[model samples]
Target: MYKYNNFYKKNFIFKIIENDIRNKKYNIICTRFPPEPNGYLHIGHIKSICLNFSIAKFYKGIFFLRIDDTNPSTENIKYIKSIKKDLIWLGFKWDKNIKYSSNYFDLIYKYAIELIKKNLAYVDELNIKDIKNYRGTLLIPGKNSPYRNRSIEENLELFKKMRLGRFPEGKVSLRAKIDMQSKVIVMRDPVLYRIKFQEHHQTGKKWCIYPTYDFSHCIADAIEGITHSLCTLEFQDNRILYDWILNNISIKHHPKQYEFSKLKIEYGITSKRNINILIKNKIVSGWDDPRLLTISGLRRKGYTASSLKDFCYRIGITKQNNIIEISSLESCIRLELNKIAPRAMAVLRPLKIIIDNFPSNKKIKLLIPNHPNNKNMGYKNIYFTKEIYIDILDFSEIEKKNYKRLILGGKVRLRYSFIIKAKKIIKNKNGNITCIHCIYYKDTLGIKIDKKKRIIKGIIHWISCSYSKPALFYLYNNLFIKKNINNIDNILSFLNKKSLLIYNGFIEKNLLQLNNNNQHFQFEREGYFFFDKKYSNKNKIIFNRIISLKKKNN
Candidate 1:
């Protein structure tokens, strides 16, 4: 229960709440996590999700999941579906059906017209290329558009024509009339609506004119009665435009925007632009590739829903931008799986063990406990035989004074099995040792009964080599090899080449019960692992290592 001190609890939630209340803070402040549904969610999004949702829960206010799917050209229904799946996987859910920027399109258009009536916005006839040029340098104010002085009726008529598809694409755009000399580029007459003749995934061709994310976001918050519009720090520059829109329309309840440092995760790229490039270039398998940091990929790679939520809470909230070491995620998962997952034996690089004393046809069965720390989950049985397998790395053909593994005349302990001493070695013409022959010590079963029995320093896991089951084991880790992605010129250079090293491995028999929907387990002396969404079927079992064996006594 000590974990409750650092974990989510009602006491801690309101404890922070009372402090904010006693400080004359805004009352009943709601928060919203507005994700643009253009790609699968990532670990970076998890940070924002936790911050916004936890604050809402902590304050006893409603939290909203609003999809900012205004840009239909780059957005899709597929992305929205993925976002909803990822969110539910993370264990956070909105109370009602989710809100969408496209859902409030008509309201946003009317509000834009309100701004037009007030002469705070106008239709710009400049080309996108020419508009950037006319915006001038940062040091100088942008020159006013030749069409800036158009009458409100003329601008509204043109806008109506734009809505009715009377204008060609790139002919004109509805832009805010804010001063062009403002330090933030967003304040320099930002575009509100564009003439995209493409069909929208949601509205299906009902409307041709679409509002930009910048123009639709803040107003959507107000419409949903969201008190705090929590978002990333990059949007800080756009806050002025958000406020300008609110003031122009005089919304009864203007939402306040708060910016926190965006998560710049090490070992991964969170930028949609970069992810899109990866997809375009065919450098990855897909958005759901196990190497990817996207939620789809993580789920495919065998990460559990609770592990992700626990990871977010462990990182907590901070105002400053920091590249989290990424090992923090590894730690959280290892801790989680170790507690819930069953214990199974697997040998990735098998070194054949031939028991000399036991008959070749003899077998042994182990009733091993599933989870050692937890009791309700009882035991499992693994069939063992004379011909068993241990990791090759756990042995040496040449005798080692310090090594207690299967060296000539040395004793070693098989994990929860028996004690054995090496007697001979079997090799092939290629000068490779294929099998190591050892004698089982009947006097010393798992632990030595006699104090004088040679103390074995080497302990290892072994599966019946004669009754081996073919399984694909995946070794997964951070995708990026470098710490600072910005420091590297090409993202491919940072790609961890060793991210996934797949190999054939042996598994205990009961493992059949542990291969669905990310059933997790820790292989003795190997690492924590789980079943990947891919490569998992009743006929074939595939697992990906969630983390290397914990770095404690091991």
Candidate 2:
């Protein structure tokens, strides 16, 4: 048995497990994360993954990665592979080899036969619609099917026929003969197995009968001796049926089920159906679209595994269902990247600045710290040339109240270099300022100038036009504009049209050496960004902005 520990007493689930261990409930604690291989795992799954894995690891128990592939209609090998990859990327090592529910099909079938022999199960010939009509709602009790009273021997024969492909799909189903008048609607003789004339991904066409998730899940847990079965609160109603199946079946280990609230973020959609609609309509590129919250999407967007785990820890485990502000998650990544991400300067919507007073042929190298606070990270060399590029947003022809940036005839400090005064402006035929003429103070490099005389209170990041490389930046925002996305009938209608904005930018030429290294960068005044391996190549560089410097007020 695992020893009691108060390390995670803040979490209610841990407290329950601690009590169970204190009372000597079992020989060892075991937990499993069983994901149905229908779609790529999302941010919501990260919560359960961290909880289960942390529980087992804390108690020195066993953790299992199980695939609940009972339904083959939507399951795919690619999804299974992606699930495993996501787990591995999250730094979790499942005990023993990965388990699949399909591997226990024969044994689960035998258990079903045992229930039939014990008069606890019966095969029904009712169609899908009639079964639903008989299984009434929460306010009304369901009535038993006419076939509910079939003898055990007849049930065995019909169930055998179901296995032999004797009936077409949905013609017959095997349901447990439980209380029909029970308040828990799922306990009203829930279907245990159904006939599907579909090919299985793992078992192939060896069997036509497939067990329902409610039927196979508990049996699989009992078979593997899972000590605590953790699931989301949506399955709270199914707990009664879960225990019913385990208690009636002849299993040595009957694991208890525990429910916790699933993670729901505001302005985000976790439903696979809704995400598919977004993809089908081409609102997003694919499942790995950076705007999405899918694990792959987040990964592609440059969210680190450690940052996600930290986010899970910050949210913690709870029974109360609530929508978490998306900023809570973004804050975790922002805090993490602030310490590790290298600082670089990039100019999106570049405004040309010609330092007329500086020597035209002079190119001075300046040492810029990779991280402001992290001295061990060392420094990087950036060139200061006669002409430089600054973000257009950083310069204004006329100054506004409390604006801390460059203006015509105003002075500002060029980051890590010298102070510059905007002397003149060059405009185009449309009266739009295309460039600015400036002069740099030769003695002000890394020097504190007198604010009383210079009035240079603002510092702006800039990259040398002669030494900068052209790049593309993908700025991502919330996929949906509505805070209450759950009530959205048409996701496309409420879609944030400007969720993804592309910009042609210029970064320090030295950044080219870090390309394809999967490096994360904080672009000085710009937000955090990751080198996009999928879109970047030898000819062109691309980066996806992970998040802005701070959350914008909606």
Clashing pairs in 1: none
Q: How do the residues 397-512 of candidate 2 rate in per-residue lDDT, one tens digit apiece?
A: 89788787898889899989999999999999999989999999989897887756747848899999998999999999998889768757788878898999999989888785
lDDT of 1 by residue, 497-534 (tens): 78778888788754765433337778887888777645
Model 1 per-residue lDDT at 207: 91
**How do the predictions measure up, each by TM-score?**
0.91, 0.95
Stretches of model 2 off by over 4 angstroms after superposition: 1-7, 452-454, 514-518, 551-554
RMSD of 1: 3.1
- Top-scoring candidate (lDDT): 2
Residue 218 lDDT in candidate 2: 93
Weakest ten-residue segment in model 2 by summed lDDT: 1-10
What TM-score does prediction 1 earn? Answer: 0.91
